[model samples]
Target: MSLAVNASTFDQCLTSIRALPDGTDGIVDNHGNPVNISSNATAISYGLCKEVCGRDSGAFEWSVFSQQFSAWLLPWLALISQLPFGAKHRSDNVMSMLLTVGSPVLGAYSLALTVLNSQWIARRFSGFKYPNVGLAVRALSSLQQVPLEVSAEYGVLASMVVLPENNEWWTELVEGLDYIHTWSISAASSIAWVVIAYLFTVIDSFANVSENIQANGQGVGSVWLWLLPIVIGWLQVSPKCDFDRVAQALEKANRKAYLADYPNPVPLSHKTGRPAFVLQHYRRGSVHRDEESSAPIFNYARFFPWVHAVEQVAEAFERASENALSHVPVGRDVPWAPSDVGVHGDNRKGTLDDVQARPRRGSPIGRWGSDVWTRVIVASALALSLQWGTTGAAFMIVWFTPTKGLGCRSGAYLLYGLISTLVWLIMLLSSIFAHYSHLPHPNSQHLHLRGVVDETAARLSVALRRIGKFVATLNAVWIVVICLFQFSSFFDRCYCDSSVIGLGKRAFYTLLLTEEDIPVLRGAWIGGTLFYYLFDFVRTI
Candidate 1:
């Protein structure tokens, strides 16, 4: 059989493959000359290629598989590349205030919750099972290895990619991503949404401006002018793909490293853990056989040694797998490499003493020793910084503007409250539906406890904990009220005719909200300021 190869290595494996008998479409080099080959040539060819690649048979197979997937990866990436623009441009208006703020909040919340749900599902349903007469084989082959550290890292990386820092590109991407999820479309949808939204909003604004201009023949600067185009351009150019790519690469590297370290690792089962009963039965049977057959004295000792060795092997495998799953320092913080086991000071006694001494006083909830606590702290701080920046801007727009005392207008405030409430309601409903759809049925069974009743109770306990946490953190009612007040418009309306405010809207919402409207715009300012701290509390919990 003919196979493609690099030109430099064309002749390297040819001699070995040329010795087989002739067949239809037989082996040939680039010149297409008939080359004799054997009936079972594929295996030999594969072995030869493996030798050329300097890899084991299995590794070679994996490499080929990765390459094949890589071949198709570009088209897939191209599809993803179209997301922000497809989703954002296709919308009916450019930078809709309702959408700009609502989209990111909804998207960030949903994405965060989805990832949490995935983590919960993976942790809760983890086990091993077998069907029918294949139970023995299943027992030997199926293992439940929980890579807790890896899972935590993956969750952290995912949250970072979804939740970016305060920036224009971030706002566009988040909002764009939210629209994609809300509609469940490809990135191409995002691009289309942006373009469409820009066109319609610009056209509508221009139509109104034209009517005003015609009414008095007043010289009106281009109404929609650069506003819609700038939003469109920002949406189109957002670096969302790079972030996702980096995140995916990290996850893949970590999982690959983990699985490599713990091949077919299984969670310890009660049956597997206690092999004393099996050994006792075997010893009794062996003694009876020896008595009947008059076996040599060495035979019993030999059998015992083999049995003990087997037990040791099983126990060692269990320990290694468990350690890997627990994220006990492997030997490197890098995912693909073994973690540095002794880096945090060997024996863990010193580490424990240091931790106890420090006590981590910033937030009580974040003092947990898990690495997840670090993520919670970092993400919380980031959220806080963004909230403060946005609140500060709103303060300036409302109270410190040069021409107008940033005061709230009644109609605009009403509009702001209405829009915010409506958007939040939709967000809440969508999240509820997403969570509900992912729930396991009520009649689920345990893998290790077919006859045991306590396993069912344990599962229920875990489920209850998860539900309680969700209810407390995802407080839908408070989030709605907070979101309603978060928008600057709720405090003060921007000068309707000022093109500068239109351009600065994203900046205002993101870092510098300066709206001058409503009676309590200043008091509401504190709410925005405190929102991030509260949000962090929710996240850490």
Candidate 2:
């Protein structure tokens, strides 16, 4: 469609058209066909003016201002969001710290993927017909795919080790591998999220560019879309170990040991008329055994491999200290207890009542009051909310936006995005529920509401895990299918005049765009910025 108005008038009409709300239609094409303003804003706007005015208009100018604006803005937002700033406590552990430090590398790798697949870059480099240049581009793009595929493999390993319930062998392997496993899992998780974020960004950017430039071709496709299920599966199967809970358990264990070392018969306190030193063992020997058995073990060796050897040394020192203490004077000089001291039944009963009424040491209520844990929870909630909001927004854009037809590449992306988002939503809800269920609760109280919440959380956890396993298996099959398509040339000849024809052709076309069609630098910029967002989600959640 050609505009027929003068330059000044055309600008005014374009401005007015943009200002009008979506679906407002007075615009028509040269054939007198009504043009929907919302379908393709820029294109329809031009078409509207062309038919309204006669053929004496100055040269028409195409505007890509929206694309330029988003190109500048979105990357910065992704970068800022990816930084390790909000949830500082997450990095206190070794596994998290490794992930944090390796984020930049992952971000760079993602950037490379984005650049290689970018339509904008492809358009610019389409002029280069040299065989050598094409080969170099293909090699670079091929290199970019390797890390992602490797990371996916790592994710599978991590899921197998961490996901199964009551599996002693896997647990032992994880313990034996220790930091090796930690680094591998962290790298896998970071890569999966990074690649996902960048792929999402690339699609969003493509849409923006498409709308801005009025480019009419099949929307981009990617094998990366198949990676979504695997990532979601990884998230579903990964264990949710609350750092705060572990820290509290360790602190409680240390406090118990300290208390255990105190003398059994302690002097009575003057103010409360209670024992100055209350031996937990004296009050409840059986209860102590039960609590110890039930208490969560915070094994340092799982995080820091060196901690195991240190623990052995510490145990030796502890034994020596015990031996020395045992040799020390058994009894200290003190006021002798008279027969009358314990003779009064009322006094003895009052002392027992006071001991019973005393608060249990290291209670859940006290642990929950920690500022660090509170900050961690708030940060996690905010991060998860942001991820859900963004994922929902992307899904809406892809699903609701008007496309050519269901046979087009846009349809494929829409289907992939929809299914992936649904799976992601399930994983997200499971994570949130897991977090809630793991919170410390008062063992003394059996509140109906708490019981209901726990039950609901447990059921959701079980259902999601089952779904995750099924999806993981499906994804494995999907990956094989995608690989067969990538390696085979059978679909190279298949093309639809109206839409993308075969799955192999569509997948091959997307890979080709990454490997040969797009320039290296531009792809890197786009992918890196978008991919960096994975780190933000990984660290915060």
Candidate 3:
């Protein structure tokens, strides 16, 4: 138990260490070489870990931001859900389903919108930025407001009103589809979380919910929590009818613009001898090319200089080849010849010389046309709403029904929603900050982007500053508001007498819930949401 002193003894030990078995010392193969496997195992393990878990973990983390907003908003949603806004309508199946289903969809849509509008505002102008929250919300409201431009001229009109061909209903249905496309990523994500929570409960159920209940270990709810969202989502099946109609109208508008650009495009060749037609806009050509002069001319002397130089090169090559190939004693069949292989390359440039140019195509209308920004803002709003809605559902499931088997699963879906929302939010916030930081000061600070566009492109210098200021202000405000709401919600849930803990203590205790783990759970919720948003922000670019 004591120390052994003396350098002599230590020296002897060191000597023994150096005198290891010959094979062990060198670790040489038959040829006697050193082997270093230190990095090999490390590399392998790192690769394995990345293959098995890294992707999912990264994905989970990225999903957190969208959830964060949801986390903040869930308490409000729960309170709203519990409110007696519709006593008479509560029992109505459609109303019940909408509140249950549509609410979350809307939340997710809002989250998506927040992100997208922010991004758009960021990308559209050089400076003077804002969060576009007002814009996002307005866009969401716009789906209801933007009149369905359906006409009886389109067959869709027939489908909107009367039963199978009900155009009016179809129009509304299209509006709803637009709504879903805008927001449902988060909604679906929340449902996915519910599935996970349900699975966790299912696993715990194997041990005994009753015993666990006695031990306050009651499992969460069934995985079927996910099923409800999916089922409810199915009601949106008819929404495509609306999308098809809208898309068709937009397409028609594009075609009209295209055709207007080329009323007759007839050939008007003069001494210049330029042809004005191209393959892309080819019609049954009213103007024809002169067949006699169509043949292209080539300069054999300049182009085939390589062919002329080949004889000199061949002499050297032939000597080398004969020396190399002849060295291989040919007792066999035919030997290889130079002419057996001929090289070819596309060196032809003659066609371009006399080629006549056609008129340039009209300016591109982009993937979407004039209403592109408006559509984008609306879409983003929908995404944000859906994300929020899902988070709300998850929070309710976990907070109110912590004993239910699907709470964790709900949490999982909430996590996914959080991620999607976060990405959107970050891009938005970046754009806003960029806009505001670059805003013009003093006399020009209040000037809008319109003025900047109209006055001079140079005015954008100030506009950029405003945009940056807008973004920074927006991000700061959003973060602060979110924190306030979150804290408020937590305080309400924790301190209130009618809180989940107070009223449901018996059930909570039965499920073995611990007050100590509350912080951890909340942290997980917020962290996950944040992680997701940050990741998605990166992805949006």
- Per-residue accuracy of model 1 over 235-264 as CA lDDT, tens digit each: 432312222332333233223121111222
Q: lDDT value for candidate 1?
A: 0.27
TM-score sort, best first:
2, 1, 3
TM-score of each: 0.23, 0.29, 0.22
Q: lDDT per model, in order?
A: 0.27, 0.29, 0.28
lDDT of 2 by residue, 429-505 (tens): 55345445545577637678887887787567557634643453354344334323322221112131112332222
So what's the TM-score on candidate 1?
Answer: 0.23
How far in Å is the alpha carbon of 406 misplaced in model 3?
18
Model 1, C-alpha of 252: deviation from truth (Å): 16
lDDT of 3: 0.28
lDDT of 3 by residue, 1-541 (tens): 1111112212333233234443332222111233243211111111222232222211122222344333333322332222111112222222322322322332233333333433443343222111122332222222221122222221111111111111222233333334333235555564455445444443443333222121111111211122233233333321221323333433332221100012221112211222111111112211111001101000100111111122222222233233333431111222433322221111100111111121112232222223334644665554454444334444443443322222223344344445434444443333333323333344565467545543443233234323433443343244334333332232112122112233332211111233443344444434433443443354344
